[model samples]
Target: MSADVIADFWPYVMIVVAGWLATDIWRWLGVLAAGRMREDSELLVFVRAIATALVAGVISKLILFPSGALEATPMGLRIAAAATGFVAFLILRQQVILGVIAAEFVLIGGWLLIGA
Candidate 1:
């Protein structure tokens, strides 16, 4: 490759390599650390709780006040789909993946119907 081609590609190459290092370095560290761990420790439980809360907040926000493509839909319809799906999921027992899929399908199906 020419010098110009190398220069153009170098930044992209560096970015990919840097991203890989930044993300995976912690995984290596975590694996090493986990080899000497205690079960159900307070710190671990706290971390889990915070992570779950953060994810739940994100999910609720997405369903309640969505943006981009979701902004096109009515908010009430979104909430109703979520509620109906949640109820269906609970009534059928707590199969989480099924619940998520049911909720997602209801939302998308509602969107399609409303959009038409």
Candidate 2:
């Protein structure tokens, strides 16, 4: 390839290699270990609980102390959106994607209605 083509493509190649190195090793390890893990294992349960808690903490942080465009929205609207989403999630048989869609719809709708 020409020097210009190499220069243009080198960054993307580096990004792909870095990303794979950063995540794929752990993924491979997990795949190798999953077959040996029991569904009722304490370690698996603990890992699941920790993962759930981490997700909850992140979601709570985003809702309570948001930055960027979300920071511009009112606190009540944010709470309402979250509550509506939770209700939708329950009503929709715990579909996470539906819950997220419901939350976004409420958030955007409220923002539009309040002209904020």
User: Where is the poorest 10-residue window by lDDT in model 1?
Assistant: 33-42
Per-residue alpha-carbon lDDT of model 2 for 1-116, expressed as tens digits?
A: 89999999998888888887778987898788777789899989987998799899998999989989899999999999999999999999999999999999999999999997
Cand. 1 Cα-lDDT: 0.82
Error of 1 at 36 (Å): 3.7
TM per model?
Answer: 0.60, 0.63
* Overall lDDT per candidate, in order of appearance: 0.82, 0.92
Model 1 lDDT tens row, 1-116 = 89999999998888778887778987898778667566678777776788799899998998888888778788887888788778878987877777778878888898888774
Model 2 clash pairs? none
What CA RMSD would you report for each candidate? 3.7, 3.8
